[model samples]
Target: MTTGTTTGTTTGTTTGTVRSRRLGSTEIVYLALVGILLVAGVLVAVRGGNLFAQGNVSYMLTQTSLLGFVAVGQTLVILCRSLDLSVGYVVALCSLVGATTMAGDPSRVWLGVVAALAVAAAVGLVNGLIIASLNVNPFIATLGTGLIVKGFLDTRFKGPEGEVPFAFQTFGYTRVGPVPVSTIVMLVVAAVAFVLLTRTRAGYHMFAVGGNLDVARLSGVRTSRTLVLAHVLCSLCAGVAGLLIAARFGTGNALVYSYGLDLDSIAAVVLGGTLLFGGRGSVVGTVGGVAILAVLDTAFNVLDVNPFFKDVLRGVIIIAAVALYARRQIDPASRRVRFGTKVSAVRRGGVA
Candidate 1:
């Protein structure tokens, strides 16, 4: 009976370990992020004396919407093994155009919004074409396009007094039962993006193309079209983000928060466990990543830390996350060895 019990126990332990290993890498990263946030929240609450404050939670969620939208788009692009460095400038330009066009006419609000989206799509198409047809690297191509977009915005505004439409402002500022309109919009967009990327045939093709373009082409996937569509969707998301910002601020400044937006989006996506090299990620992870970033920023503010330090800290965290992710990809055996070594070291120290 004792021998049989020992064997059963060993079998159960092995089965449990196997089940744990089956969990997706994204899920593991997400849990790590959640753990980090929880620890931060606890520390902040211990210091500030409140974790359940309505004001703090609302402020964090509201601020998250901007980066959240951009991150969702970035997730899609990265999944396709491409990057969009132009999102920040594209956003600035779109917001400027939307704000300037809507400044006086509430009736033409929809028209301006449509035009902004069209321009964004056009910019994306140009990026896709340059990269695909001309054999240009996506990084350089998007960077160059971003510069052009910035210059155009600078020339268009020539100053900071661009008018934004009242209706557009309403979309940014209006609340639905204490939730900001922008937040609602972000959620809706995320949900739609999630469904498209996970539940559709195009999504499968996207994964195939990202993982191995040559293989994907040989498998009869429309690789070029998939790349173009990914960029278009990315630009569209950026345009929507710009519109939300314009509505929230009630004006369009040529350089308003453009510099940090792209970095934040990239960081958010990476932290969500999407491999920078591509072929893996989900909108759900991206949202959680956004929430983690937002929480970190809020915690910094509540603790009276310098806002500049937040950027520095964000850079550190992003680099660390990426490094860890890369290590996970390249050295699964190394991780296991490291884990065993640590355990042995701990036992030795305890014995000593």
Candidate 2:
């Protein structure tokens, strides 16, 4: 009986240790944020605040679904140490084209969607090709492409609104019970992205390339191809996001989101604990970041805070989070030694 008890204790200890190790620093940070948010949410609820009301929650989720999709793609691109500034414009153009093509044609909704996706993919391919072939910086390459695409969209849709089919719009408004379909789609996308990044060789190569381009190339990794593929995926994500937005609005607007989405996507990626330097992040983090942002927005609306102030708060939060992450990455031993030396210097000065 004593032997069995000892064995059970040993197994329990082993399980605890494994569980502890499985929760990495990023996961810990995420958990902390979640806890804080939960507490805040509860407080807001107890205050009889409208933000915690069911209607607000549903509205927030609906809004988040649109930008959350783009943010997911942005996280992947940023993970590879690259940025795609053109995502907003890509989304705008795709949305416009999709809506225009499906205008009043319920039977051809799928065709329009396929065509829009093809265009998005083609645009992404072009962005990848130019960046890879010319060795141009990704920012400049994608920005230029984005401008061209935006211009084309403006010319195509000049001064007129394009209607989307009623059937397609149903996806934006329809819910399975209380949950929005867009939210479900975002969740699925997040799940797929998480699996790809964590479980696939392609995901591994993406990290390798981002972590060290020269080393990855030397190790027979296709650095260029990986980057190109990353861009393609990023743009594809933007395209899907655009379609969802169009469906929600039931019309295609030229301005789409007025470039706010670019900042929002970056904010979501950084807030999710994905290092700005790349090669270390998860789709789960991105999703959490999105949720945090959405919750904050809902809170702000409930409190009736100025819209512009949210941007200021967001910037400050991003800077502080990145700084904290950087500090954590420093070696503990090195930090301790530095602290010791500082103490020694102070003691000597006092003696003198």
Candidate 3:
């Protein structure tokens, strides 16, 4: 709810009551999450089980961390009116880089982390450079980059390779009072992303570019730099996910690509109510979206739903999300035609 104020020359001031504002998308997402939890709890109770069990909650958080990292990155890229289909490949590749650098050596963990992030950032740089410099369609540019990485993974790596030290493994598995450290890290990353998008110059420029490229360019925004920065940050997040993967698995598995993280990450971003084509969205809503997916996964497990059915349900979710926001693509404020309104015989107010 909000209010409006007006001032008149004769009258000192005037106020008008405005209609209550609708809930924000982020708020709606959390409310939906609560509703889902309540409903899922009831469904689980029917089977003589409790969905709110600490273990179950922790498990969901654990799973959320994995997808959350990539999804956060996806959120940034999508907000910039750009896309990176190569994130899944980056995650998988970074896992290998981190693990292989460690090579079972505990002392080299920092080096491994650096190596992975460097590789991830490099890939992001390439993606940004290609799209921004060449004016390539983001979808096609990212897809091509992803395919290149996929090819490298296929030919150079046959299976899992390298190892992670036990010390690092704890980074992935450690828990504090029902919360996994990895989840905490993910939330921290989200916080950073939120701040970047809401509080910084780069973030403002990103939204401007995504909102209207020509307007932003005319406004003196360094459009290319902004896009490149978004891509770099996006890939960095994926690198973190890779680190988590290596820590958890104790080895880098090239097969991580099969997890379909690229699409899953995108799904989370869109479900958060971000404009599909770009420009308008928030990371807070994205976090809520990730939580929603986590809750659904938990619900599915409690209900003993078949694994295959989960895919079907996920398909329905992605489609529904796209359908929900598709209407926004058309601007209602634009001129509408065929309304039978009388007009002078002129074109755009000029001589006919």
Candidate 4:
């Protein structure tokens, strides 16, 4: 009788623990987003402005759209226990490629997009090859790739080049009520990515590889292929961000590499409750992280805070939040202690 009771209790407890661990991290991220917004509202109010004004809301969403795309891709790569540092460079290169191809012609917009993405894909392939085939450390491989792209960009383009047709530019500027069309598109991409991560066999392999590489290999997971695919997807997302820039500015600026998007995307992924070392995260939480950053950006602009100081403040906030998140996830008491002692006692009673 006691054996059955203890077995039932242990199974229920273990299942509960697993479910909580899966959902808890994402909940914490969303709660952080809410906290950020409330604080932003107060700061904006102090400056005699409403944070939720239609204009302000549009601006924040617009910002979220751009970062959200790149961050979504970053989330995928990070989930595989790898990283991409060439995203900013990919953005700059692809933007210029698209703009130069279009050359302000409406009919050529499709051609421009295809050309740009093709280049982005090529860059991603190179990154994947270096990392997966050559066995280069991902950080060093991607960093080198970024530098090479940067050198090529600086040498070839001295200033902004090419123009977006008026129609193409509308994709960046069009809004329905307070929501930008671009934001909608970004959300759709995120939705697709979310499904890919959570509802696919490839996704399971990625999580397994990330959770433990050797174990994944032993289980027949293709670690190299997964890593390569992650980097490619990350670059493709950054390329889309580049296209957005082209649409917004009506031209491609060579200096877009200076925008620091690579780091910012990584920051969003980390802030979204993803482990730096890989495995265990969700794209939904990443959207919340992007929102938090957008809110911060909007709030600082309203407060007239110095841009450099805003960077510092953002860094500090990320550090504290990540520290707390890590603590909760890594605490053994939550996992081991809760199950270990009780299960051991139950087993001992049966043995006795």
Candidate 5:
């Protein structure tokens, strides 16, 4: 019994040590992004550009807020070991649907917003049901759903149509001093997401479900429900983003921002150090990731970099981020440390 106690104690110490070290490594990635942002700002400044200028900063925040909303949703879906390719079109559809509802009268703008959210929620529910119940590959399911959304939009409208209410547009443009209202919205969403993931039971279930569905199920976690919730929330985020877009532009365009938004949001989530395989991530990291992309994109424009090359650079960044995280995941030292503790626990007659 004494020997078992000693072994358990040692195992606990080893596990704690490993966790601390791993956390440090994760923090480094976020800090590195901060450094990158500072460097990018300096480079932009060196080129006689003011990255910190009031106007530019406001613009960056507004744009980042839009992308950030989608990225936050992507983070949740990925955390559940699922993907939401349908989000891009969800944005387009919500924009069109909501704008269509509000076109007749400005007083009905709130109704349009509610209608857009309902559409988004319905689409998300279908996605969750199909993938969770049928055991369909999340990637394939979401992609198919996305195509369907695109088809619906195509058949419904040829180009930009409908008008957003003037008041709604004004709200989108409202600024709190130098900060835009949209940016405030983004920050609030992020804060809520951060709290949910880090401080709530549902968040814990999501991470567990993402880490291992079978284990989560064995633990009475209701893995299917968790996954469905993730997708639902993801769609809601997309819906909000669509509304913002409609308000910002005062119209909905089926073609606008259709191509890169999905990829960009995924890239931002990955950049924030969230594992693509799911389970391990932070909303703060996602925020950092979004800022990195925003900084780079802004820098590219200010530096006169070719538009074509920006895409290439973005692809490279995504690949590099994935590779870096993969390396950390498979590191022999970390793995051995984690595995060793379990092995020791088992030898001591404990359930590893």
Candidate 6:
């Protein structure tokens, strides 16, 4: 009986160790980045003297709100081990189409909203179908779709032409108590995403598919459907963001948010420790990542950093984050090799 009890305790300890190890490097990077962000915010606050001023804080929140919308969708896509490069075009095209349809008519804005969502959903479906059915690489498929969307937008509008209704602009500018409505909307979206990922059957299936597509398939999870759903959801998120952008600016500019938002969203998602390969991540971590990016940008502007330098810094952060993840991927194989080499050395030593 004592032997069995001892064995059981040892097994429990082993299981705990395995679970802890699963989050090893990812957790380290996440915590480290958080620390860095906090330190940077402090330094900027001291230097700028307005980092936490109500107005500056509101501006930061507004900026983060826009990027957060895109990051949430990017997290879902990456969680499923897929990419949606079309999101940039999705934002541009949706905003342009919706604004043009509205033509500054407040009463007709709902029609524009419907058109935007429909186009967004259709784009997502095309991405899903082409990648899942045709077995095209997601990167290539989304890229192609993005180009097509961009082409359509270019043909429709040579420049920013349509005006968003004044009533619609309120959604992007209103403040609830002390908070921007955009920020509130982002919080709601993040909360919904968190619950969906943690509580729903579909979310579980998505993670399973991302972790191991073959295993998920064998276990009766519909991997193809999960992939399709992820892309569709991502596009829908972009559509929402596009509409908000149009309302905020009161006009649609195809070139305004075109590509920068995509790169920023991806960078934030990756910085939050979501593996680009998918299968493991947290929406909460993504929230932190988005905040970090926003804070840095805010600080840079306050400090009057050159635009070129800001771009370089962003590129460095993204490359560093990706490299850290890549290192983690190589660790298990390298550990096995080391273990085998050590065992061989022990055998030779014993023989000698």
What TM-score, computed on C-alpha atoms, does each candidate reach?
A: 0.85, 0.85, 0.88, 0.92, 0.89, 0.85
Off by over 4 Å in 1: 1-22, 49-51, 330-352
The alpha-carbon RMSD values of the candidates against the true structure, listed in the order shown, are 7.4, 8.1, 5.9, 2.8, 3.8, 4.8
Q: Count of backbone clashes for each model?
A: 3, 0, 0, 0, 0, 0
Candidate 2 has which clashing residue pairs, if any? none
Q: Model 6 over residues 318-350: C-alpha lDDT tens digits?
A: 788778777777656446545655665566566
- How much is 113 displaced in model 1, in angstroms? 0.7
Model 4 pairs whose backbones collide: none
Best by TM-score: 4
The residue-level lDDT of candidate 2 at 296 comes to 78
Better of 1 and 5 by TM-score: 5
**Greater-lDDT candidate between 2 and 5:** 5
Ranking by lDDT: 4, 3, 5, 6, 1, 2
Model 2: residue 223 alpha-carbon error in angstroms: 1.1
Candidate 3, residue 223: how far the Cα is off, in Å: 0.7
Query: Between which residue pairs do clashes occur in model 3?
Result: none
Residues forming the 10-long window of minimal summed lDDT in candidate 2: 1-10
lDDT tens digits, residue span 38-127, model 4: 988988888789999998999999999999989999999899988899999999998999999999999999999999998988888899
What is the Å distance of residue 312 in model 6 from its true position?
2.0
Kindly list the per-residue Cα lDDT of model 5 for residues 235-260, writing each as its tens digit.
99999999998898788778754657
Q: How far is candidate 3 from the true structure (C-alpha RMSD, Å)?
A: 5.9
- Name the candidate that leads on lDDT: 4
**Candidate 5, residue 175: how far the Cα is off, in Å:** 1.5
Residue 333 CA displacement from its true place in model 2, Å? 3.5
Displacement of the residue 37 alpha carbon in candidate 6, Å: 4.7
| Model 1 per-residue lDDT tens digits across residues 226-247 | 8888888999998998888777
